[model samples]
Target: MNGQMELVSARTVKGPDPVPDLAAVDRLVISNSGGKDSIAAMDEAVNLADEAGVRDRIVVLHIDLGRTPGGQSVEWPGTADLARRQAAYYGLPFEVRRLGKWPSLFHRIRARGQFPHLMTRFCTSEKRAAAHRFITEQVNALGVSGRPARIVHVMGFRAQESRARARRPALEVDHRASSGRRTVTQWYPVLRWSEAEVWQRIRDRGLPYHWAYDAGMSRLSCSLCVLASVPDLTCAAGLRPELAREYADLEEEMGVPFRRELSMAEVIRRAGDGA
Candidate 1:
C-alpha cells in the first residue's frame, strides 16, 4: 500500500471526483455487499465512469458467505438478490463468488472449538483472503488474454463509519499486485461520505437495498458477527431463533463460549431481559 496517503476531509468531497486516467484502466471492480454504503459507492463509481465515457468497464462483484448449520444462510436473506438487481439496474455486469464446501462460519467455529475474537478475527481474515483470491484470478484471466490489466478495486468504506476507517486514505496501491502487465489500485470513493449522505445517494438513485437495514441491522456483513452490538445480536436472535440456538448448542458442546465473558445462552437471556 505505497503512496502519499491523503486523508480527504468529508466536508471537502461530498461526491468523489472521477478517476484521472479512466482510459488507462482495464477494469473497475466494485465490491458490492448489498448494503447502503456499497450501493452508494457503486452509484458514485458508475457516475465517475460514465462521465469519463468508460461505463462499459465497470463490474460488480459480490462474495457470498456460505450457510450456517440447519441449512440457513449466515448472510442476510436477499442480499445477493438485491446486489444482482442493482447491477442490472445500472446495466453493469455482475458476478457472485463463494468459498468451497464446509465454508460455513459455524463449521469453522466448531472445528476450531472456539469463536473468533475481536482482536484475533479469523472469520474476517478468511473472507478477505477469498475475495483477494478471486480478484487475483480475474487479473490473471485478463493477462492470459494478452491484455494489460490495470484494476481499480473499489470498496464502500466511509470515514464516518469508524475511527479506524476515518484514518484510511482515499487512494493507495493495494498490497496484492498482479505480475507484469497487471496493476492493482485501491479506491474508496465514499470514504468521505457521511451515513446520511450514503442513504441519500441510494434514495436519489431509487435503488432497493437489502431488507436487513429496515429490520434494524446497522451492518450486513454477517448475521451474527462477533463485532455485533447487543442490540444487533438481539435482533438477529429474534429473527432467527434456530440459528441463535445453534450457537448456544455449539458453545455447550465445546465447553467454550462465543464471547470470553458471556456465553451465547447468557447473551440471549440478557436480550430477553431487555437489559
Candidate 2:
C-alpha cells in the first residue's frame, strides 16, 4: 500500500514579499535508528547542513525500546551504543529517549494479547509517538525561552525501500503544530538514494555499523519484526534461540501466530535445514 505524503502550509508573517526565513531555524533533529539507512541519512543531513551553513544546529536523537522480560533488548545488541558512538564521531549532541517503563515490544504484545502485525503495526506507532513527544517537548522549551524554534526533522526513509516510501516527498511541512512559537518540517535527505549508495557512504566514513548487518540481516529494526523477510527471521531465530522460544511461547499463549504462514518454531527449524 502506498502512503500519501501530507501537505501543510508553512506559517509566515504577512509582508510585501513574505517568505519563510531559513536563517531563523533553531534546530535540525536527525532520527538515528542505528541502521544503515539511518546512518546514511545522518551523513546526508550533515553534509546538507554544512553546505547551507547550519551544521552547528544539528542534533542526533535515538529512542531506546528498553529491555524485554528476559532482560534482553528487542533490538540488536549495541544498537544504541553504536548510535551514541556515531554521534560522537560526527561531533553532534546525542539524546536517548524512551516511553518509560514497560516499553518493551514483548510488554505491548502481552498487553494486547498479540504481536504487531503488518496491518496493526503498534510497535512503529509507539516508537514514532515517543520521538514526536520528545520533539514537541524540545519545541515547547525553546518557545518558553522566547526563541524562534523551527525544527527540521530528518528521517532515514528511502523511496527505494518500499512502494509506500516511494510516494513520500523530499520535504513536507508537518501537519501537527508544535509550540505556538515553533514550526516543524520533515525532510528526507536521502529519499532517492539506492541501497548501494547507503553502504558506500558507511564505508567512506570507515564507520562500524550494527553487527546484525554483518550477520547478514538486511533491515535492522525489531529483532523479530513482523515485516522481517524469511531469511531475516530465520537468521534471527538461529542467532537468538532463547528469544525465539519466548516469541513462540507468546504465540501459543495467544493462540495466534505472529507470521501469517509459519510459526517461530517452524522458522527456526527451517533455518537449520541446510546445515
Candidate 3:
C-alpha cells in the first residue's frame, strides 16, 4: 500500500518479485504466525487474491500452540489476536485454531526443568504442526470444495534465519507436512527476503504485528520454548527470569543435554551481549 514503492532488492520465487503476479493462485491462505515473514505473506496473499478475482476466498490461518505462559501465547496480546486484526484488515475470514492447553509427558518435563535441544522439537509437533494438519485435513474433506483446494499455503519463512532454513527452496512442496495430497501446495514467497525485508514489509504495510520484539524477543514462539538460541534464551531469562529458571530446572530434571552445552546458565550469561 506504500504506493507500490519498490524494495531495494526484494526477491520472491519469481525474479522481480512482482506482487500482482502472485495473486493468480486460486485459494490463497496466509499462514499467520505473528512473525514478520508470515505477515509479509499475508500482504502478498491479499494482493494475489485481488488479482486472481477471488478476494472472497482469501483467509488467514492462526494456529495457537496453546500451552505457553505469555501474552503472546494465550493472553490478550497473543499471536491469535495479532492474526485476527490482520485478517479483519484484509476482510478475510480469520480461522483461529488452538492446539489445546493440556501438556504431554515430554512438554511437562521440559516446562518443569528439562531443556529440549536442537534435535528435539516436541512442542512444535504437539502444538503448531498438529493444528495445521487438522485444518488441512478438514478443508480437504469438505464436500463443496471441488477436487480439493489447489491452495497456495503462503508462509513467511526466511532462509537466512538458520543453517537448515537456508537450505529450503524458495518454491517447493512442504514435504514435511504434505500427506501426498496434491491439492495442498506450499509456497514460501518470502523465502529469499532477509530479516530486514521482513520487518520493512511489515512497517511499510502498516500491518498489525506482535510487540514481543520490544521486550528483547527475536522470534515470537513460546517464551521458554526450546527452539531458542543461546542469546535468545539469555534474553528471555533477563526479561522473564522465572521462565529461564524453569527451563534450567527442566533440563537438570530430564538428564538429557542440549547441543549448546545443554546449560541454561550459559544462555543467561549470553543474553544481553547477543551471544
Candidate 4:
C-alpha cells in the first residue's frame, strides 16, 4: 500500500453539480472499453441508474477504432467480443460502432518520428476524444427523454493517470460542449477509486475485463500508445511478436525513429538481459 492510493468520494466531500439532477438524467452512457476502469465505471453507472430508478434507460457505448497503432485485433474482434460479453453480463443493450476509416491520420502523426510529449497529445484528440465524440453524437441523435441531446456520459478516467485529471472536478460540464449543442454532463463515479478498488469492484460485481491487462498490459491505451515506458513496451513487444514486428514495420514505413535508436526487438532483448 506504499504507492497505492484509493479513490475517495468526490461528491460527498464536494457538493454535486446541480445543472442536471443525478436521478433525472434521461440517459446514462457508460463509455466502456472493456478495461478495468471502464468495467468499474460501467458497474457504478448501472448501480447509480438503478438506485435512481433509471436502470432501464442505461446503455453501453462501445467504439471500434478500425486499427490501433499496434494491430487490428482489438478493433476487428477483440473490442466487439469484449463489449458483447460485458453487455450480456450486465443484461444491458450495447451500441457498437466502427469508425469509417482507420485512425490513419493519427497513426501517421504518432509514427511521424516525434515522441508525443504532453503538449502534442495528438492521440487523445484523434483516438480517445474521437471515440467520445462519436458516442455523444449517437446519444444526441437518439435523444434524451423526448428530443435528441446529450445526457450524462460517464467515463473511467482515474486521477492517478495524470496530474491534470487529478485536479478535475467530480462532476463538470463536458469540456467538449460546443455552442448551440445540448451540453453533455460528465460524471466520474470511480474517479475516487484506486486501481485495487477498481479490480475489487469488478470481482464483487463479477464484471468482465480485457485480457490485455492480465497479460501485463497496463492502462489499455492504443496498443502503440506513446505513453508506454521502455519496460512496458518490451513486455508487449515480446508477448506479441507479430505486433512488435508490425510496429517495427510501421516505424520504417512511417519514417519515424523511436527512442534508444534500437528496434523494439532490441528493447525486449535488453529487458531480459539483466534479469
Candidate 5:
C-alpha cells in the first residue's frame, strides 16, 4: 500500500485517491446492482469495513427500477433478489428504493418519446436521483449533531469498463449528496480491479451472482441498456422476445428507432437469426 509502489503484477491495486478512514464515516452504503463488478466491489468494501471495525455501519442499497407494462423486467430477471441475497451473505442490512413518480422506466421513456442516449442518459440520472433521495433519508434519520454526517457511497465501476470510468478516481467527494447536514463521499473500492480478479474474488467468497452471465451476458445492467453493445442487445432480445417486442412497439409508436444507428426491430431480427 505504498504510494510510490509500482505494483504492475497485481490484478487489483489501489487507485489514485487513498482509501478513506472507514471508522470516521457515520454510514457506509454499498450500491448493489447484482452485477459481477458490483459484487466484487461489495466484497472489497465489506473487507475494509471489517478491518476498520465499522462493519455495523455498512448497509447495502438496491434501486428497483419497475418492470415493463406487461410485467417483464426492465433489468435482468431476479437481479434485485440476487442483490438482497448478496447483502445477506455479508450479514448486512439491505434496503430497496424505487422511483417515486414513475412506475416503470419503460413508462418514462414512452412518455418522453425518446430512448436514453449515450450523451443524454435520463435513465441513469433517474436512478442516481433515487439513490440520492435514499441517502438523504438516511442522513436525516441518523440525526445531525454539531457536525455533518459522513456518508460513503460505494459503487462498482471498473477501470476496464470504459475510458470515462477509467479516468475516475477511487474516491471523491460527492457534492450532490453533500450538504451542511452531511458529507457524502463516492468510493469505488474495486476501481482498479480486473475482470478476472472480480470473478476470482466472487469465487473465493462463495457468493452467488446473477445468472445472466451464464446465459451468455458479459455484463449485467438493464436487460436492454441503450449503452449496451450490439451483441448484448441481440442476446437480450433473443432471451426476452416479449420484452423486445414491447420495446419495438414503443419505437413504432414514437416513430423513432431505439438507436439512431439501429432499431429495436433490427436487433430482434438479429437475435432471431442467431447473429
Candidate 6:
C-alpha cells in the first residue's frame, strides 16, 4: 500500500503465472504463515482484489500449529502475532484456527508415533483439511442468494522452492471442497516469484515480516521441521534450545530419527559446537 507498487498482473496457463478472477469470487481467503513469501502473496492478492473492486471480500487466515509439552512454541515464537500484524497492516479481517481434536501438531504426531516426512506429510494434509473446513463453514454462513458461493483460497507457494511446488499449478478448482452450494478454488498469487522478488516486494511495501528471518532462518515453518536442511535445523536449534530439546526427546521416545539422515540431538550438538 506504499511506495510505487508494482502490482501483480494476470496470466494464462500457457504463458505465465495464473491469477485468479478476484471480482468473480465472493471471498478471497489468504492463507498467511508469517513467512516472507506468504506476506508477499498477501500483498499481491490485496492489490489485485483492490483493482477488481473486491477489496472488502479479503480475509486473512493463519493456522496456528500450537505449542510444545514444555510450554514452548512448536512454531517460531510470535509467528501467529506476526501474521495478525500483517493482516492488520492491510486492514483485513484475520482469523486463527487450531487443530480441533488435538492440542497441537506435536501431540498428533506423538499419538501416531511418527514425524512427518517428504513422502508422507500428514502435517500439511492436516493443516489443509483444517483450512478447508473453516472455509466451508464460512461459505455456509454467507448464504448466497441463488448461486453457489464462489471462493478462492489464496496461498504463498513459489515454484522456486521445491520440485513438487514447482509442479503445482498457480490456479486450480478445489473439487474436494466444492459442492452444490459452494465453488472453491485455490490460488497461489506469487507462485512465479523468485526469492529476490519476494524480498523486494516486502521491502517495497514496508511490511512487517517474521523475526526468524532476521535471526538467520531462511524459511519459517515449525521451529524445527523434518524437511529442513541440516544447517537450517542447526540454526533453529541454536535459536530455540528448549524447543530443540523437546523434539530431540520426542525422537528418542519414538526411536525414530527426526530425519533419515540425522537426529535432532545431532542438530543440537552441531548447534552447540558452532556456538
> What does candidate 1's lDDT look like per residue over 17-125, in tens digits?
3343555677788889888888888888788788779898788998888777687787877788889998999999899887544577778778878999877788877
Per residue, candidate 3 scores C-alpha lDDT tens digits across 1-275 of 11112111244444544332333344556778777677887786677556657787667787765543322232214667787888888788887665554543235445545444567655555555655665575556543332333445677877787788778755554445544343445667777787888788788888887777877778876665566666666666677665566555556667654445546656666664566
Model 4 stretches astray by more than 4 angstroms: 1-20, 68-77, 103-117, 132-136, 143-150, 259-265, 271-275
Candidate 2 residue-wise lDDT, 1-275, digit = tens? 10111222243221221222334457788999899889888887786567668778788999888777788788888989999998888899999988644668788888888778778988888877787888887776665464446777888888887788888766666656454565677777678878998899899988668998888899998788788888999888888777888888888989988777878878878777832
Candidate 1 vs candidate 3: which has greater TM-score? 1
Mind giving the per-residue lDDT tens digits that candidate 6 earns over 1-275? 21001122364532576676666778889999999989998998898788889989988999998987789888899999999999999999999999878789999889989899999899998898889888987887788877678888999998988998899988877778888787787888788888998999989989999888888989998889888877789999999999999989999999998988888899999999994
Query: In model 2, which runs have C-alpha deviations exceeding 4 angstroms?
Result: 1-22, 144-148, 177-181
Instruction: Identify the runs in model 6 with alpha carbons over 4 angstroms from their true place.
Output: 1-15
TM-score of each: 0.87, 0.87, 0.75, 0.78, 0.94, 0.93
> Model 6 TM-score?
0.93
1-275: candidate 4 lDDT, tens digit per residue:
11001112233521352223445455667777777888887787777666667777777887665554555443323756787788778788887655444454335454455545567765455555555666556656665443235467778887877888888866676646422344466777777778888889988887777777777777675555556766667666656656556656655666664443555546546645731
What is candidate 4's CA lDDT for residue 50? 69
lDDT, candidates in the order shown: 0.76, 0.76, 0.60, 0.62, 0.87, 0.85
Error of 2 at 102 (Å): 2.7
Top-down lDDT ranking: 5, 6, 2, 1, 4, 3
The weakest ten consecutive residues by lDDT in model 3 span 1-10
The parts of candidate 3 lying over 4 Å away from their true place are: 1-26, 68-77, 100-115, 137-141, 144-148, 175-182, 257-260, 269-275
Clashing pairs in 5: none
Backbone clash pairs for candidate 4 read 7-192, 7-193, 7-194, 143-148
